[model samples]
Target chain A: MKIYIPNSAFLGNIDPFLRGFDPSDPGTLEITANEKWIAVHPAVLSMITALGLTVKPENISCRKLEARSRHYLVRMGLFRTLGISSDISIMEHEPAGRFIPITRIRTSEELSNFKNEMIPLLHLEPEQSRTIGYIVSELAWNVLEHSGSEHGAVLCAQYYKKSNSIRIGIADTGIGIRASINNSYSAETDLEALRLALKPGITGTTRREGGTEQNAGAGLFFIKSIAGINRDFFVIYSGDALYKLLKSPAARPRLHADPFDDRHSRAEGLPRWSGTVVGADITLDQTAGFSALLDAIRVTYRDAVRERLKARYRKPRFI
Target chain B: MRTIRLVEKTGAFAENKDVARALRVDELMPALERGEEVALDFTGVDAATQSFVHALISEALRRFGGGVLDRLLFKSCNEPVRKIIGIVTEYMQEGLAPGE
Candidate 1:
């Protein structure tokens, strides 16, 4: 396996970075980066850490990074997470209101603890904290419950000062969406599985309308709606398919049951990611009230269930 | 009626599904089964995830039918918590089988 860290890889232009990932040799991992500067979204680091964990420490090799901004990687704990030594020296500063380093959560307890500690570190407003907390909880829980990855979920976040937004990335080298959703639904392609996974009342655990008592199958939909209502970018990649909800231009963006129905872009036959990677950008400046967002969710969720039920309704026989 | 203080089980933010499940399987379900009304008091909880709310009440609705809502009381819920619970109940009812 091999990956190259480019100069810029935020959610908007992360496609080439993802496309460059080579998952050919699972036994060995090579990480190389540009020599000038290295700046990327938390999702990029999370993906590298997730992929690195799949190989033996001795088998993983990283080229000496000469980028002037190489310390950002060190600060983000990328090399430390992968168990490699970058041999770069830099002054350490307080991380408050800046970023969350690469952290691996393997249990529910860890996730709960992380959430408790995450808010203060970001120094966000009460409403903003709730939104971030909600996203991390839902995304990480999906990994813990369904990913089936031994290493669990790797996640990190950064508060972008310029955009006044929080960028988050979560990756897991476990069963991809196709495998998980196929447990109950017959989705033939990875993209189809993603479509079902995003829809309300659908889960890999069961085909029933309400899902199992534990999972309402509404987590992803809620997260997507949050991003849509805020007019931010949200991306999900599993196998060779990727769905990106493009940033909306409307003052009030409408939520869609089908992810493809939103202003979005997709790619098929890309380099396959064995697990799943999700990246979300939440612009705090324009965040909608959490309660107001729920009002919309309630309407869309009920409508989605009604549509599915109507689709299954039998037609009367003609005389 | 037996009242369960949720903040004691889950802190201000109730996102942990395990605690919700325990309260459901251990406390809520047993009390509902014994013909006692259960009031889930969220006196100090600020917010809750949809998953946690579903884990806590969706099963009771499934087993006892929608009538369970009549016996279950949500107390001291803030706006966000109330909305989350409302969403869960609405969707569960929408998905329930006919006559359930």
Candidate 2:
């Protein structure tokens, strides 16, 4: 038996091959490129294998894979990191920066190792590397806390020296933003859920569920605030909704949420991402003071939260 | 005065468990009880998240109240880490509010 996905089955395709895959059936997973150009995200294969599917890159065969973008190389690196063989020599090449190999962070040891390995690649000072490590840890931890994906999460990173930016991409094939937020609050759409998730102190966990101690719903909000440290951008995709938080120097940052756009358009009509993918483009400014930047964002977030709470409770703000 | 260096116990990747092990509130309680000031030196630490900061400090705040913050000193925190510590402190303080 064999399972194959042809063409550019990117992130938007979600689980193109796992709709009704039988666990009992012994089948080989194959990804064949029918077109001259093909692009695949790291999450696609990581999530599939995490869900009990035994698809190793060595076991899987690829045919006529061509690169239209660096994405092709990154995807190949992702598979190669999983001990799969490919035509591309990721070790010898550095297109933008090296891909940290799409990996599943399940245990504390694994997560720590991933962070340690990724930081040195940034080649920043001790203080600068730690800051990025902290941000990555919080985002990856969200997969364990919120996603509830049986397969854990898929994470890959790339640093573009020309752009002076580092991009960390993390995806999880779990109950998405809507399902997670809807667990406690009434979120009807993915966009609404994402919006609510961005709000500080808003979490899907309830009171009896040990919510406050485990989380204060401040992770993503902090990520959003800090990504603008040197005017970086943050983007999140889940379900049919795509969210982008853009940073500007002259004006305040803006968040645009669109239910229609998934950053990819398929003429054959693929499915929306069933999970969550967060891509953060952080501009590398070694001289910038993160403490001062954090203080500013802290004041802004506190004021916003205070104002919202004041309106909701109709009482004096006491903080 | 006892200075607890974070990097000594945990490497660059500091998590909630790492913080817990680094600063055992139960063990530190005796020091606080003995009127010894505890300074958390985050000099070699790469980065720390809100969760890691909150885990140990929140417990101390709950056990010793706002007075603990005075005895508890955070030193050598870089801009990014200092910011996270500040956020966690503020959040824990908010949780101490009346009927919050």
Candidate 3:
């Protein structure tokens, strides 16, 4: 496998970066970055780390990074995670109020601990902490409960001081959404599986209206709604399909049960990612009150379930 | 009525579903089966995930029906926690079978 890190790749223009990935050879990985500079979303790091884990560290090879900001990768714990030596030297400053170095979470206890430590590192207000913490919890838990990856979830986050927003990336090299959703429902394509996975009350675990006691299938919907309400970008990629929720207007936002209903873009037949990758941007400046967001979620969730049930209602046929 | 202090089990932010499941299967369900009312006291918890709330109570609602809510009480919940619990209960009931 080969991946090229371009000079700039965020949620907005990450498509080219993803399209550049080469998944032909699973036995080894070659990582190359643009010479001058490298700036990417946390999701990019997570994807690289997840792919690197599939093979032995010896099989992974990285080009000598000459980017002026190459130390950013070291600071983010990239080479350390893949067990490779970047040979880049830099002073390791405190991570507080800046970023969360790449971390691996394999168990529920690790995730709980990570949540407790994550909020304080960002130095956010109580409200902002709750929002960020909520996103991390739901996204990581989805990986733990459903991904079926032996290595679990690899994730990282960065606080963009310029935009006053937090960008998060999570990836796992497990069964993709199509396989997971197919456990209970039939989705013909990876894109269809992603659509079903994003809808409320739908889970790979069960087909019932309310999911199994453990999973309500509401995690992804809630995360997407948070991004939608904040008018930020949220992207999910599994298999060869990518669904991105574009930024909304500054006016009051309406949550949608169908992800495709939102202002979004999609791609099919891209480089196939065996696992799932999600990138979400939460612009703190536009964050709505968590309670108010919940109010909207309550109404939207109930209506989504009602609509699904209504769709199943039998019609009297008189011919 | 048996009151369970959630802060002792979940800390300030209650996002762990394992603890919720334990409280449900080991404490909440047993108490309900014995005909005792259970009050889930969230004196210090500020927020909770929907999955945690769902794991804690969805099974009881599924097994004993929506009327089980009458015997369950959520005490001292902050706004977000309260809203999460409300969402869980609302959806469970909305999706419950007529006789389930």
Candidate 4:
């Protein structure tokens, strides 16, 4: 099938994704397939699905990114997408999969509902839930505030037992991370904006009504921390440039590596991407310290959100 | 477009002589009956004194009835001035008075 994945696919057709190269522009695929179809990576299938394409798991095409490939960094902790010709396998496609499309409009009330209703279903501890919910809110805020589109975005999360992993994706056609940040830092050159976004305190939030710094420059950083805690793999694609936190720093935390080591080549062994459509993904094993990490974050957020509400409402003092 | 000339001005929309929130919408009902391309230009007009875009658009759409809302247009929308118009138009369907 001539499936049309989003031009933002985390690791879809790569040759054209490199900067200065338009995503719609085509490039030769290294693999030529027929018969049982191409054995593709799980990342490709997901990117396709996010674009609102329909592909049977059985037709999953497999292609591998070289360890040195830019897309390679995003492959952290994620299991390869396996073909499922029949539903008979122990792994079943989630029933809610098709209903959740990328780029859906959501209200603030719905955001609250996600925190209250779905968090429990995920069975994560309090802190885990808090951090997850916060991350979810950040993603929602990013879409509502930045996506130029009317419908913002809809998040689709699924759990696959076969590999004991959860895959979550957030997609939007908004001004994208690159465009929005560029607008914020008009002084910086294009390359400079990309580098600045990687730093800890450079969040690009100025238009927020009250302008809370706690949230302003911290979304990406917090999201990255959560991923690290989960020991999950991640991909961040924005403005013809993609950065993959492939291996969770936790698994092989970035402690020993020399940040100053400029031996040779661009971004040694890290994931790379080149696309304007913005988003990222992560894969983590349940065994990692996810349970404790999530618990701590959830409790912290639970207290914070609770306290904020209490202060705002004042307990409706009874005479 | 069903236009409302607000009787007074306030926080956001002020200075516009042609339209304001407290306008006699009843007076504009007949103009809409003519069913012509309507454009609300806030020229020489300052900010809208009161928030009437939502109510006005809702009523105009209802009076003009079918196939005309999209044809209605606006010009010179400042951020707040524009916000009222956007809130009304963007959520037009949802913002419709419940049963109406």
Q: Can you give the TM-score per candidate against the true fold?
A: 0.98, 0.73, 0.98, 0.43
Q: Of the candidates numbered 2 and 4, which has the greater TM-score value?
A: 2
Give per-residue CA lDDT, model 2, range A1-319, as digits (tens): 2333344443334335333233333345444443455444444434443332234455555554565453554443545554545565444454545455567776667787787676676677665665567677887788877888766777766555666665677777678887888878997777778877776666787522113544666678777666654556566667666566655553434321121221222222123555777767666763246666667656655654555445556567899
lDDT of 2 by residue, B1-100 (tens): 7987778766655675544544765555567778899998887776677767765576666566667889999888876777777776665555454533
Worst 10 residues of 3 chain B by lDDT: B4-13
Q: Give lDDT: candidate 1, residue A208.
A: 93
- Best candidate according to lDDT: 3
Give the alpha carbon lDDT tens digit for every residue of A1-319 in model 3. Answer: 9999999999999999999999998999999999999999999999999999998999999999999989889988999999999889986563434788899999999998898886578888999999999999999999999999999999999999999999999999999899999999999999999999999999999999899989999999999999999999999999999999999875988999999898999999999999999999999988999999999999999999999988999999999
TM-score of the second chain for every model = 0.97, 0.83, 0.97, 0.55
Candidate order by lDDT, decreasing, is 3, 1, 2, 4
- For model 1, how does the per-residue alpha-carbon lDDT over B1-100 read when each residue is reduced to its tens digit? 8999999889999989889999999999999999999999999999999999999999998888889999999999999999999999988998898998
What are the lDDT figures for the candidates, one per model? 0.92, 0.60, 0.93, 0.39
- Candidate with more favorable, higher DockQ: 2 or 4: 2
Clashing pairs in 2: A130-B46, A130-B47, A291-B79
**Which runs in model 3 stand beyond 4 Å of their true positions?**
A92-97
Candidate 1 interface RMS: 0.6
Candidate 4 chain A has its poorest 10 consecutive residues by lDDT at: A256-265
Compute fnat per model. Answer: 0.81, 0.30, 0.89, 0.00
Error of 1 at A115 (Å): 0.9
| Interface RMSD for candidate 4 relative to the native interface | 18.2
Tens-digit per-residue lDDT, B1-100, candidate 4: 4543332232222322123323325444445567655666555333331113433454565444434556666665554445435433433332223343
